[model samples]
Target chain A: MRPLELRRIPLFATMTPADLAAVATVVEPVNYQRGTVLFGVGDPCAGISVVLDGIVRLFRRTPERREVTTGIVRAGGLMALCALCGEATHRDSAEALNHVHTVEIPTAALHVLGQRCPHLQEQAMRGLLERLDAVNAAFVIAQEQIPVQLLYLLRSVARLDQAAQRHPGDTMHPLALRLSHAELARLVGTDRATVTRALRLLEEQRLIQRKRGHVTGVVLSTPDRKVPV
Target chain B: MSDGGNRKVWYLRHIDLFASMTDEEVEEIAHLLDDHHIPPGVALLDHRDHDRVYLIKEGAVRLHTGGPEHQVTLALLPPGRMFGLSSTVGDADRTINATTLLPSYICFATWPKMAEVFARYPEVMFQLTRSLAEQVFRTETWLARLGMISPTARLADLLVELSDEFGEPSETGRRIRFRLTQADLARMIGVSRETVSRTMVELGRAGWVARESGRLVVRDRDALKMQANS
Candidate 1:
C-alpha cells in the first residue's frame, strides 16, 4: 500500500509522511475467502492483521465442538495484537466472516515501526482497549434475557444503510444484518426455537424487520416514531 | 531510596509488564507509582473513574459491575496484576468497580505517566497491548462458559481456573488462597447463590472439594478437572 493509502487509516492518521512510508514498506495486504480460518487457537502468532474491509469473527470451540462467537472485527480493526507480546501462540481462532481484506504486519516489523513512531504504539493500545470494551459488553449481555440478548447481537453486527447516511434529515438509520436464525442462536447462546420466539417478539415490537425471501437476514431501523407494537 | 521504596521497586519488578525491563527502567517506572494502602471493603477504582492504572502489590481485589442489588463479579485480580487499563488508552470508561477484598497495598500511575513510559520504551506498549488482549480472550471464554454450560460445570471450571491462577500446593491437592464466598462465586459464574450452594454440597459429598475455615480446598483434582470438561 502507498503511504497515502496508509495515512487514510485513523490509526495511522497521526503518523508522519516518513513514518507512513516506513510502515508501508513492511505491511502486506492479503485476502481471505468467506469461512476461511485466519488463525486457530495455539497457532503461532506470525504478526498482526488489520482489517481493511469486510468482517472477521474471533471465536473458540468448546470440548463438545460447539463454536462460540467471541467478537467481530470490522473495518479498520486490529486482530491478535495480544499475541505480539512474549506469548508465541494465538489465544483464540479468527475466521473470515465474509470476504476479508487485511494488512498483515509482521511482528518484527511492528516492533521496529513502533519504536520509531509512538503514534502507532498508542493506536495499537487504543485498539486493544476498544476490544476490551466489546468483551465487557458481551459479558453484560450474557446475563440479560434471550430476546434482549438477541437484539444486542443484532445491533452489534448490523451494517449501516447508505440511504441514512445520504439523508441527514432522516430520523431512522436502517441497519442490515445477514445471519441465519441458527447463526443468531449460536451467537446468542440459545437454541433456534428460542431465537425464533425472540425474533417474533422483537418484530412485534417493531425493533426488527425481516427482508422478504431472505429467511437468513433482517433489517433493523432506529425508532423514528414510537408506535405500540 | 528508603526501605519501603526499595520494597515497592522489588514488587514492581515481579509484574509481567516490568519483568523484562532493566533494573534501571523498572526503577524509573517504580518512581512514577504512588503508593496506596486500602482497607478491605473500599472501592479502589470505582466505575466511571478514568485515567488511572493500579498495580496490586499485596492482597486481593475484586473487579465487579452492575448495581449492588444485581452486581456481577468480573474477576478477582491477585497481586502483580494491573487493573484500570481502560483508563490509560483513551476516553473509554471503566465498566467495572474494583474493590479491595482484603487490606491491600497498591501502586498507581496516571495515564500521562504511563504514556510517557510507553513512549520511552515502545516494547512496554506492545506488552501492555498483549496483556489487554489476553484479558479480552479470558473475558470471552468466561462469557462462553456462562452462556453454554451447566451450573455444575461452570462452578467446576471456575474452581479449576482459580486454583491454577491463585493456588498454592497443599497436602490434599491445591488450595485457593483467596477467600471467595458463595455469592461471589455466583457472581463470577453468572449464576444464583442457591445454585452455587447446591453444587458445592454435591462436590463436597463427592470428595472433590472441601471448605476449611471459609477457604476452598480442592481435594480431588482429577475429579474436578473431569467435571470442568464434562
Candidate 2:
C-alpha cells in the first residue's frame, strides 16, 4: 500500500506542513478487497480509519440477522473517530463496498499528536461535530414515512458518489451505489416491495430517475430535497 | 448571571466542556461570556450562525429541525452541556435548530474568545471532543430504540428511564419531576401524540401509570418493567 497522506484526512487537515510530516509517519495505509468486512459490531475500536480510496458501508444486523445500513463513507471520509468519545467498541460493523484503501491512526497516537500539533484536535472535533449533526438528523429521519426515508437515503448515496458525477449542483445528483432494491431497502430499513413502490413514487414526482444501463441504478433528481423529513 | 461576575465563573466550572480547565482559566473564559436568559420556545441558535458558542447555565434546550406540523425532536439537553462548537470544530456548519425547551440561562461567546481559551487550555478542547462523541452515541442509541421498538414498549421504557433519573417517591407511586405533555412523550418515542394518549389511557386502565396534578406517576413499577422488557 502507498504511504498515508495525513493532509488528506479532515481530522488532520489543519496540521501545519511540519506537523503534517510528523503525523504522516504515524498513520498506516490499509487496503481491503471488495466485500471485505472491515470491522464487526462490538469489536474493540483500535483507531480511526480515514478512507483514501473507494467506499465503505457502516451497518447493523437485526435480531433476525438482516443487514441495515446506517451510513456510507467514500474517499476522504473518516470512520471510528467517534472512538475519541471513549467508546470501547465499534457501535456498528463496517464493510468495504469495493476495493477500499484507508489510513488507520491509533486513538492514543492521535491524542499524543494533538498535544504536540496546533489546531489538530480542534479541527478533528469540528469534523466530529458535523458527524454528530448528521447522526442527529438520521435519528429524526428514521421515524419518517417511507417516501421521506427513501429520499433521505438517496441524498446520502448521492453524497458518497458526488466526486464521480460530472453534473454537480443543487439538482439531480447521479448515484454511484448501484445497489438493488433489496440493498436499498436494507439501507432505508424497509422491505423490498415497499422500497420499490416508494422509488416509483419518487420517479413519478421526478425526484429520482433509474440510471441508464443499470437495473438497480437510481439517481437523485434533486440533491437539495426539502421536505418534512 | 443576575448574581453577577463571580456567578459566571461558577457556572462555567460545572460545564463538562470546561471540566478540565483550572478555576482561574474558567474565570477568564467566564469574563468573556455574555450571559442571558431565553424564554421557552425562543430559538437559541440559528443553523447559519456558527461563530458563537453557548454553555447552558440552567434549564433545557431542544435540538431539532423541520417545522410545526412535522417537527422532529433531536435531543433534550440538560444543564452543563455546551453548544456551538466553533472553538472545537472551527468554522463548521450546524445542521439542526436549537430552541429553549424551558426558560434557560445561557452563556455565549464569540469564536475568537473560545479559540483563545482552547489554545491556552487545550485540555478543554479534548473534553469538548469527548463530550460531542458521547452525544453522537447517545443520539444513535435513541435512534435505534425509536426505530426498532413498539410504541407501547418505547413509552414504558422511556417512562422507566426518565423515572430513574427524575422520579421521586409519592403516595401511590413515583412522580416524574418534569411535566411532559403527550406531545412531548410522542416526540421522544418517535410516535404520534394520539398513540401516547391512547397508551396512557391503557396504562391508566391497567393500573400501570397515572397523572397526578399534570405530572406522570409510575403507579406500578413492576408492571411497567414487564411491559418495557416485553
Candidate 3:
C-alpha cells in the first residue's frame, strides 16, 4: 500500500514540521487484508490504531453471536485511546472492512511523544476529551431513537473524512462511503425493511440516491426550520 | 447546615436537601456527616449491594455498569447531584458503580440519617423525591433508546436533546457546540462499529449534518428534528 502523507491529516494539522517528524518516527506501519481481526473483545490493551488507509470496523458480538459495529476507522483518525489510559482491555474487536493500512503506536511511546510534541499531545488529549464527551452523550443515546443515533454517527464520520482530505472546504470534495443496506440496518438497530423504507424516503426527498451495493450521489438538505413540537 | 469544621459555608448551603436548614439545624445534621477521602479509581458502591448513601462534598463521580467490560458510562455526576439516591428508598444493591474521577471528599450517610431527615423535614423529603423521580425518568429515556431505536434515530434524538439543552444561536441557526465521535455513537446505540461508520456516511452525504473537529455540527436542526421523531 502507498504511504499516506501525515501532514495532510486534520488530527496532525496543528503539528509543526518538527512535531510531524516526531510522530512519523513512532507510528509503525502495517497492512491487513479484508476480514482480518485487528483485535478482540477483552484482549489486553495494546495501543491506539491510526488508519493510514482502507477501513477497520470495531464491533462486539452478542451471546447469540450477532455482531454489532461500535465504530469504524478510515485514514487520518485514531481509535481505542480510552482503554489504554486505564488497564481495561478492548471491549470490542476491530476487523478490516477492506484492505487496510494502519499505524500502531503503543500507549507508552505515544505518551512520551506527547511530551515531546505539543501538537501530538494536544491531539491525544483532545481525542480523549472528545471520547469522554462522546461517552457522556452515549449515555443519552442508549435511551433514544435509533435512526437519529445513526444519523449522528454518519455526520461524525463524514466530518472526519472531510477533515482528513487535502482540501477540506472545497465543494468538489465528496465522501465516498461504501456499505450495504443490510449492514446499514443492523448498525442502526433495525432490519433490512426499515433501512429500505428510510432509504426510499431519503431518495424521494432527493437527499440521496442508491446505486449497486453502495450509496452514491449524496447531498445534504438545507438547514431545517424549527418546527413546533 | 453545620459549619462543621470551618468548611466553606457554600458547601453546606447549595445542597437543596440541606439548603433550607438553619445554622442550628445544619450543625445538628452535620453530626451525621462522615467525611472520607476516596482514592482515585476505586469503586465506592458495588452492584447489588445497597449499604450506604454518599453525598459528594467534592470530586467527580461516574456511574458505570458492574459488568467485566465496563464499556458503558451511565452518567457523570458532579457535586449537588446525589450519588446512590436509589438506596434512600430500598435495600437493593446498587445498579451502577460509583468511581471517583479525582481524589476527593464524600459524606457517607446511613439510611437511618436519611430516614430521620425525611421524617423530620417534609420539605427536604419533597425535594429529594422530585429529584429522584427526574433521575428515574432520565434513566428510562436512556434505556428506551438503547432498547428500541436505530443508531441514526438515537443519534438524532441526542442531537435534538443537546440542541434543546445547550444549542446556541448563530447565523446558521441554533448550533450545538458540544462535540461527539462516531465510536461514541456506536457504543451509545449498541451497534457494530461499522454500522455507525456506514450510517454516518449516508447521513453526511444527504446533508442532515456536518462533522467538524469530531463534533456533529447540526447544520439543519429541523431536518434532524424530523429524523429524531419516532
Candidate 4:
C-alpha cells in the first residue's frame, strides 16, 4: 500500500507525512488465499504484518491435534507483534480466514520507524496488550456455563461487525456469524454436542439466532458489549 | 544512592528490556524506578489496576486470575522478569493478579516513566515487545496443554517446566527451590487439589518425584519427561 494509505491505519495515523513516506519505503505488500498458513508455531517471525484486508485467525494446536482458536485479526488490525519482539519465534500459528492482504514491515525497519515516531510504539504496545487481555478473558470464560460461554463467543464474533459498522444508526444491524457449530465449540472450549445444546438455550432466551442448524446471524439492539459470562 | 539502591539499579540493568542499555542510560531509567519489598501472599498488582509495570529483583511471583476458590495460575515469574505491561499498554483492565510467592524485592515503574524510557530508547520498547511475546507463547502453550492433555500429563508437564525454569542442582537430583503445594500445583495446571494429590501419589509411587520440607524434588528426570510426553 502507498504511504497515503498507510496513514489511515491507527498504528500509523500519528506519523507525519515524512515518517509515513519512510515507513512505506520498508512496507512489503503480500497476499494469501483463503486457508493459507501465514506463519506456523516455532517459525521465526519474519516481521510485523498489518492486515489491510480480510481476516486472520491465530490459533494453537492441542496435543490431541485439535485447533484452539485464540483470537482473530481483521482489517486494520496488527498480527502478533510478540513474534517480532525478543523471542523472534511465533508462539502460535496464523491462518487466513479468507483471502487476506497485509503490509509486512520488517522488525528492524519497524524499530527504526519507532525511533522516529513514538506513537507507533505506543500503538503497537496497546494492540499487544489488548490481545493479551482478550486471551486472558477467554481463559476465564472457559470456566463458565456452556450457554454463557457461547454468548461470549457470539459477541466476540459480532464485535467485528460492530467495528465495521460505526454509524450510529447501524447499531441495530443484523450481525451474521460465519462460524460452524464445531468451530464455535472449539473457540468456546467445549464439544459440538454441548455447543448445540447451548445454542438452543441461547435461542430460547432470544440471545442469538440460527439458520439450518448453524448460527448465521444476531441482532444487537445496542452497541455490542462484552456479556459477562 | 545507598548501597541497596545501587543494587536495585544493578538488577534493573540485567532485565531484558534494559540489558542493551548503557550504564548512563540504565542510571537514567533507574532514577524513575521505586524499589518495593512485597511480603509473601500480598498482591503486587490487582486485576482491577493496570497502570504500573514491575521487574522482579529478588524472589518469585505468581500470576493468577479469578477469585480465591477459582484462581488459575497463569505463570510463575522469576527474577529479571517483568509484569504488568499489559496494563501499561493502555487503560486495559489487568487480566491477571500478581502475588508474591515469597518475600520479594521488585522495582516498580509507572506507565509514564516507562513511556519516557521507551521514547528515549526505542530499542527498550522492542525488547519489551519481545518479552511480552515470549509470555504470550508460554501462555498459549499452557492453554493448549490444559485443553488437550490429561490431568496427570498436565501436572507432569508443569513440574518439568518449573524445574527447568527455577530448579537448582541438588545432591540427590534437581530440586525446585520454590515452595509449591498441591494446591498451587492444581491451580497452575487447572486441576483440583484432589486430582493433584492423586497424581502426586502416582508420580511418587513411580519414583519420579518426592517432597521434602514442603518443596518438590525431581528424582528421575527421564521418567518425569517420559510421563509428561506420554
**Highest DockQ against the true fold, candidate:** 1
lDDT of each: 0.76, 0.73, 0.58, 0.75
- Sort candidate 3 into its docking category: incorrect
Candidate 3 lDDT tens digits, A1-229: 1123676655677777766776777767888998798888778766777777876766555433456554555666566553344334765578887788877777667546554554554454444334433433444443345444544444444544544334433132234666577777766556787777766655565544567745654443223521111
Interface root-mean-square deviation, each candidate: 3.2, 4.3, 15.6, 3.2
Leading candidate by lDDT: 1
| Local accuracy of candidate 3 as per-residue lDDT tens digits, B1-230 | 34545464456566766776787776666676687778667788753556578877766666665354334556555555566644211111214567876576778887678667655654455444334433433443454455444567767766666566545666544555544456545655567668878877776787866665545666677887677564
Chain A TM-score for candidate 3 is 0.72
Q: Which clashing pairs does model 2 show?
A: A126-B89
Worst 10 residues of 3 chain A by lDDT: A220-229
Give the winner by TM-score: 2 or 3.
Answer: 2
Candidate 2 residues A138-229, lDDT tens each? 66667778888787777666666746355445555666667678776777777989988887777777677775522233444343554432
TM-score of every candidate: 0.89, 0.85, 0.47, 0.88
Query: What lDDT score is found at residue A227 in candidate 4?
Result: 39
Docking class of 4: acceptable
**DockQ comparisons of all candidates to the true complex:** 0.47, 0.39, 0.04, 0.43
lDDT of 4 at A22: 92
Select the stronger candidate by lDDT from 3 and 4: 4
TM-score of 3: 0.47
**Model 1 agreement with the true structure over A98-189: per-residue lDDT tens digits:** 78898888887877787888888888877877787777777776776888777767656654234533552423234454677887787666
Single-chain TM-score of chain A, each candidate: 0.84, 0.82, 0.72, 0.85
Across residues B18-107, which tens digit of lDDT does each residue of candidate 1 receive? 777998888888888898888888887744557888878888888777677778766677777678875321112324678887788998
